[model samples]
Target: MKRLWGTECAPAWRAWLDRATEQIFRHPDCGAVERELLDHLEDKATDLMRIFPGLTREEAEQRALEEMGAAEELGEELARVHSPLVGELWQLTRFLIRAVLVVLAVECLWLLWKFA
Candidate 1:
């Protein structure tokens, strides 16, 4: 998944977030969810590092990932909540509305030309 605001993140964390967010149907919502998950992961890692002063940053991050459980399962649960069918329907509706507006604009322009 693409990182927001060009912020750098660990490769492992990025990979896990990508796997989890990929299951979401709506692309727009994926970014928000990824950001939220990343915040949680970072907070967990920070707590771990504080608790264990000797632990390296990478080690702390690793422990946090382990605590989060499997990415695929989390993704599947997220997918269910996001609803692929609803996302598809929303996309279709937006496209149809745009097309209708374009058609109406052209018809109005033609009518104005005919009257003028």
Candidate 2:
């Protein structure tokens, strides 16, 4: 998210973590308790690596990218909960894009639909 958002917003991100923990604590579901445990482990690992600041800049960028990928997955899960239609639309768009690419490739090979 830092790449899509901004690197300087890490403090804001920290605040988000606090809010999420509070939400989990308030949740009535049993699975949320497990999520809280997992969140605690993840935060500990992140803080562990963060405290030993000897990694190179390149390594740091790679770590940030990995973290962002995980965050994007989390964002998708949250989006699924709030706006499932948006998620469905994004899925449909991706499917159509792949179909178009496949159609163009077939046209390039023979200028026709050989299979059909």
Candidate 3:
């Protein structure tokens, strides 16, 4: 499974979180929701690292994941409260637009390199 947005180094925990919350991305308030989730994770990681100064970023991330509860259960709960059918389509469109821009940027860079 792919890592969660902020858990790039903690694949073990990230896989669980990513699988659980994959559907939440379609929620209308996805930007707010994602920001909240990342903030929570950051706080948890900071606390873990403070307690164990020697802990690596990955280790802190795993500890934070453990405290955050199972991703599937949490995802279900959040989806129930937040997901909107029409909003899903809107969210998807926004994501696609962003992705296309990124691809265009990469292609432009590649072309510039070739022509230079």
Model 2 — which ten-residue stretch has the worst lDDT?
Answer: 1-10
Point out where model 3 deviates above 4 Å.
1-14, 25-27, 85-116
lDDT scores for all predictions?
A: 0.87, 0.47, 0.72
lDDT by residue for model 1 (61-107), tens: 99999999999999999888777787788889999999999999999
Better of 2 and 3 by lDDT: 3
- Give the number of the best model, judged by lDDT: 1
The TM-scores, one per candidate, come to 0.68, 0.33, 0.55
Between candidates 1 and 3, the one scoring higher on TM-score is 1
Error of 2 at 72 (Å): 20
Residue lDDT tens for model 3, 8-70: 434565466565666665533544565677678888999999999999988898888889888
Lowest lDDT 10-residue stretch of candidate 3: 1-10
Please estimate how well model 2 matches the true structure, expressed as its whole-model Cα lDDT: 0.47
Model 3 residue 52 lDDT score = 94
Score candidate 1 by TM-score against the native.
0.68
Cα lDDT tens digits, model 2, 1-116, are: 11211223234344343333332222232134335534554564466468757865445544544554454445445534545455567779999999999988978777555644
lDDT at residue 102 of model 1 (Cα atoms): 100
- Model 2, residue 63: distance off in Å is 24
- The root-mean-square deviation over C-alpha atoms between each candidate and the true structure, in angstroms, is 5.0, 13.5, 10.3
